[model samples]
Target chain A: MERTPVLRSEWLKIRTLRSLPGALLALFAATVAFSALAGVSEASDPGFDPLFASLSGVIPGQIAAVSFGAMAVSSEFHQGALRLSLAAVPRRGRWFAAKAAVIAAPALLVGLGAALAALLAARAGLGRAAGGLSTGEQVRGVVGCGLYLMLMALFAAGIAALLRSGVATLSLLVPFILVVSFVIGDATGTLADFLPDKAGQLVLRETYDGTLGPWSGLAVTALWTAAALLAGAWRLCRRDA
Target chain B: MTSIDVRDLTKEFGGRRAVDRLTFRVHPGRVTGFLGPNGAGKSTTMRLVLGLDRPTAGSATIGGRPYPALREPLRHVGALLDAQAAHGSRTARDHLRVLAASNRIPDRRVDEVLQETGLASVARRRVRTYSLGMRQRLGIAAALLGDPEVVMLDEPSNGLDPEGIVWIRTLLRRLAGEGRTVLVSSHLMNETASFADHLVVLGRGRLLADTPVRDFIHARVRPRVRIRTTDPVALTSVLARHGHDAQEHADGHWTVDGARLDDIGRVACAAGLPLLELAAEEGTLEQAYFDLTGAETEFTAQHQEA
Candidate 1:
């Protein structure tokens, strides 16, 4: 069978699911809300990068994006949904590809909208402090921030497919992003640049002192996402529904 | 119409074989009852046939092609492995719409199936709110959406009300009458026996008997004759003297074992006994099933614990 119908079917699944749409709404609200709050706070340090400060809301906003990706695949495991889905499409690879596409599209779109909104809301509160930022830097930060959020969502989707449970995926990912990354990064500086969350966020910074450049940092995160996706595909094809 | 051919199919899960080297053929124009006790591997065999699980050995094919190899599998064969296989949060219509969309089926087909399965009124409700019977009806609707030539359902009568059961029986008969292949797996032997023309019986993951429903009963279960005569006392004494085991009922009926209708008629005529009623009876499929599975237990020492 042609793949177009399968992709459309997967898109319908995401659209019809309450949690997925709710997650996207939360991603927009949390990112914009937190960034605006940060914009009102005083700049505590001399080395604060205005661009990174304005985009910092993504730290919390990314939780919603990852939740969307994880929930999309995890729902299939519940109540034998995967069996029905596979019965309709049969070929595991085609089904997985269609499912991954649905996750990527929404995550990317919501990520862009949230990233742009966060930048504007923060810039409004920062006043003159944000004025010194170059136009090219702001543009790069917005675009990179959007791509970074999408990558995290895709990464969570991959894990969800492999684990076949939303709770398990969220349990592992949320703690690693919130606690492990900060604790490990604070303990060691150079190694933090290669971590997926830390490396990808480097693009949001106006001035960086990390070993990886903005684009190169995204490359590291992209590689991690690719690895997770490939592993998920392998698991999905090899296992019985 | 299509045919199902399962040859030496086997599957092992955690070192225990769920489906043994089972072989059977289901042809069009009849409802083939796939009957077995609980844990007899009926569902596992169905799963293997649908390509939902990779068999450890051998193969199962529909129309001479593996299920996954078909260009449009649902158009050729529609299967319902589990009734709870749908996402609970979506409306019944949306569930079928998305499934129909995947196979490139039209929206009208979804509405048609809903109407056919008596789910049209509840199509807009979330599956979570639907009863188990409603879920079962939705599953049947999905199976019939493509108007497939081959239909496989694992216990379609489960969770259905008496009316729903009767509806499915009529539907299966209608599909078979159209020269379509229908394989229905159920542990309800008598229920299946009523609608199915053919039977493919399994016991402990092995083929027990494969024959027509009537033939299976007559072949596996011994024939019996019930005789009611004007002089029951005389007939009982005569039968005992003739070395025949006969059980007497208070209503002047004697049940004779291993006696043909012709033999009884011959004896009654020679004895000049007036017969009020003489009828030959066969055991039901339910009894035959127990005999077959009971016999299997004597030969096989191991079976699935699940």
Candidate 2:
């Protein structure tokens, strides 16, 4: 198939690596298992939302996707392959753009797959308690969750590019995503609503809180990704690799 | 003509100067061996030429333009800075394929390079599985994938075995024979002695000498003439009178400097000295390199400082 040369090359690089597939498989397994477990545990709860339970797998699944995205660029630096890449495409900005496009595709696909699998598992496990979701709400929840995962992955990719170390990027990303968000949510009453994960979770809810609606919350999460990516691009352009 | 030009390029790392006011030209149709000890700025100079690192002052151009300004730079200049710097998880072919794709080079060219560098047998294997020599071959293959006009390799034979080393030497000679400019950096003077047509020597971030390889070898290396005679003491005195320094070895042989074999034989005949053996001892390029850059070698000074 005819494709942009840089993007096609990046896609080949990502798919050929053993870690990329391993990460995706782990994301898929973790999402499905977590959702199934959540579904079983909440089967008898009075106000159980099947879709919500199904999508709960995204909590852990995002980590895998984030690592995949981060490794996509950082591995090049670690391996010294970035030198070859730069020698081929001397325009740094265009190379960054192509890398972003290549990473975004699988992220979106796997994310959507995980979200869908979680939703289906939750629906099946809930049995009679599962309410029929309206077509609009169902679409929003599924697409929003996928979009959220994609942006989260991009956020990790940006941080990895900036730091240029896999361990350091993971150390920083894990705490911010898994722990600091909760700490801030408990410590600050209203300000915590703006945190990426919290803001992103708002999209999966059918009922609106006083803060933001589904699409707006997704938009906020996208803004966060864009900001991080812009910072990464700026660093990439100005700094010597 | 495709060539590399550096105009007063200087780079500083913090307070330490890595490269200072270095300017030289690498012309096509010749192999220019860049000689320098560690921290003498050979790699830094190559990085400046490739635009991988920014120069604090001055500019470096490839084919009359900045490297970054070139459209599809690999086609103009191909470089291999570090052989082992590649991602370990990637297969050898995948590594070359990605780089070729970026330059819009066809996949066939990637295969061609793999075969050319004798890496075709291991093309499907991951780079981590390859030994150091194999990895060096892969790096060279990647550099050649673009079929570039100018090729630069820094310390290309650092970890290679004897066979691999010979392979590289031959490949570099063949590349230059095809009318491509090949610039290779090495600290081993023996490695570049017979392979390089031109030499650019660096010491303490400064250009020490840039001349033809033959001229460099001849000017810096004095061929020692060894002679064994019954009257070694008399011969030593006669050589000293002729302004030639002769040192008597413990084995009763006199090693004379600044005199060729013919001159030694003529002197011995005239002085009525019967010589048991007389021959010219060719000095290695290693001794010549030491004589040229030993005084200004930065790594040695750093060791002393430490």
Task: Please give, for residues B33-145, the per-residue lDDT of candidate 1 as tens digits.
Answer: 99888888999998888899999999999999999998767788888888898888999999999999899989899999999999999999999999989999999899998
Which CAPRI quality tier does the interface of model 1 achieve? medium
**Top candidate, metric TM-score:** 2
- At residue A44, candidate 2 shows an lDDT of 68
lDDT of 2 at A125: 74
Off by over 4 Å in 2: A1-3, A43-50, A186-188, A208-210, B227-240, B246-254, B261-279, B301-306
> Compared with the true structure, what per-residue lDDT tens digits does model 2 show for residues B1-306?
799998899999996889889999999999999998888999989888888788999999988999989887888888988888767888999888888877789999999999988889889999889888888888888888789999999988978898888888899999899999999999988888768999999997899999999998778888789999998778888887778888888888888877799888888899999889999997778988988889977656444632
When superposed on Cα atoms, how far off is each prediction in RMSD? 4.1, 3.1
Per-model TM against the reference: 0.91, 0.92
Candidate 2 DockQ category?
medium
- Candidate 1 share of real interface contacts: 0.83
Off by over 4 Å in 1: B224-282, B295-306
